[model samples]
Target chain A: MSAFKKIIPLFDRVLIQRVKAAERTASGIYIPEKAQETLNEGLVVAVGPGAFVDGKLQPVALKNGERVLLPPYGGSAVKVGSEEYLLFRDSEILAKLE
Target chain B: MSAFKKIIPLFDRVLIQRVKAAERTASGIYIPEKAQETLNEGLVVAVGPGAFVDGKLQPVALKNGERVLLPPYGGSAVKVGSEEYLLFRDSEILAKLE
Candidate 1:
């Protein structure tokens, strides 16, 4: 691992790391290894200042250290600290872990 | 290449397939096979009816036959027709392809 690509998500954005999808759930069930898809779990590393609402700044509902579900189809992947991370807007987050 | 899971996103949900990342784009630039990262680029397969707003359903601004950029972390991956696809809400979509 060399220099990590500096990532700075703008307004209301989020940085998530994809959780690896290991082997199947037994019974020979296989989870396909697709390029465009990622796992369901992720750790929130960085978050944007907040989202704009009705022309005003609205604080984000998601916070750091929160395990969240990211939208598989809307973020950008970047290498960071020898690992890969995804950048997305606040709306891309589907659910937050309670 | 068999039976695809019947996917009907309830409201504002979307189904996307992960594009496979092959051989580090040559040049030995290994994209790392750590098991979590996926490639960009996917076909919009299915979308949810619509997302629930405040207390009611709002119309979706996205349309079918559109290629979209998916969030890297929020959606759910499922098997559909021998292929893997991800499911996420409409909000997960960031920029639409013009």
Candidate 2:
């Protein structure tokens, strides 16, 4: 987590870390690595200041630590040490997960 | 053009009619339809009120009758009688051509 502290996304960009695939089922059965389903869920690690609109700064709608639904494609990938993070524009995020 | 008057795009959407491919060159040589290059230029037909930002309506940056650069893909296609038009969010338009 310390490595990720250095990154600060710019201008309505959100940095998200994808949730890892479940390794075991709810019933406690182990799942093979090859069969793990890729999840579209992510945790917001950092957020940028809102973009300027009509000369006014509009703040980003998301906050740090919020879970969000991610689009299947389009984001800048970054590797912090061994962990991967993605940066996306606020509009690119599909929804906020409750 | 009367067919298009019925359309009023909503929320920062811009209606654009693509510029037609040239059938003849400037040097007076006739170009076959198959050889004509598809141009990404378009004329703005209409524009929606800008999308709301920070609880305020931010009006679209484009105006009707302006020439604009279109993205290679991603716009809602609409056919008005025999004429085809595209509807795109203001942000999707690449640029405004002077």
Candidate 3:
């Protein structure tokens, strides 16, 4: 957590950690690496100040600890030690998961 | 131009046409396709209504015909007939070229 805190996204950017895929099914069937379905779900870790609009700075809508849906592709990948994270603009996020 | 008008970007999304790379140098040296360097510049074609913030919609900063810098990656590619365009959030645009 301390490592991720060191990162401060700029201008409507949001930092997120991708949720890992399930290694096994409910019946205890192990899924192979290639067979695992990659989910586009993520947890918001940090958010940047909103971008300037009409010469004024706006506030971002997303907040820390929120679960979000990610697009199939895009976003900048960031590495913190062995942990990986993603940086995307608040607008790039598809939706918020309830 | 009429064809591009059909596209209406949603939420802070921008429609852009990538600037073509130069095939020849000022010295008239022909550069092969493999040697051609792809540029990250684009011409703004269309823009979406600003995303909602604080229960109100803000307006996008970029306007049509503006030259902009694009990120090395990201953006959704759209094909209209033989022409290709890219859709990206206004915030994804790096800088506006003067």
Question: Which ranges in model 3 have alpha carbons more than 4 Å from their true place?
Answer: A1-98, B1-5
Candidate 2 lDDT (Cα, 0 to 1): 0.80
Q: After superposition, which runs of candidate 2 have C-alpha atoms over 4 Å from their true positions?
A: A1-4, B1-98
lDDT by residue (tens digit), candidate 2, B36-97: 99999999987876667666988988999999999999876655447877878899999999
Worst 10 residues of 2 chain B by lDDT: B1-10
TM-score of each: 0.43, 0.51, 0.51
Cα lDDT of model 3 by residue, A1-94, tens digit: 1122356565778889999999999899999989999999999988877787665787887999999999999887765457878888889999
Better candidate by lDDT, 1 or 3: 3
Relative to the unseen true structure, what is the Cα RMSD of model 1? 14.1
Alpha carbon lDDT at B79, candidate 3? 90
Worst 10 residues of 3 chain A by lDDT: A1-10
Output the better candidate (1/3) by DockQ: 1
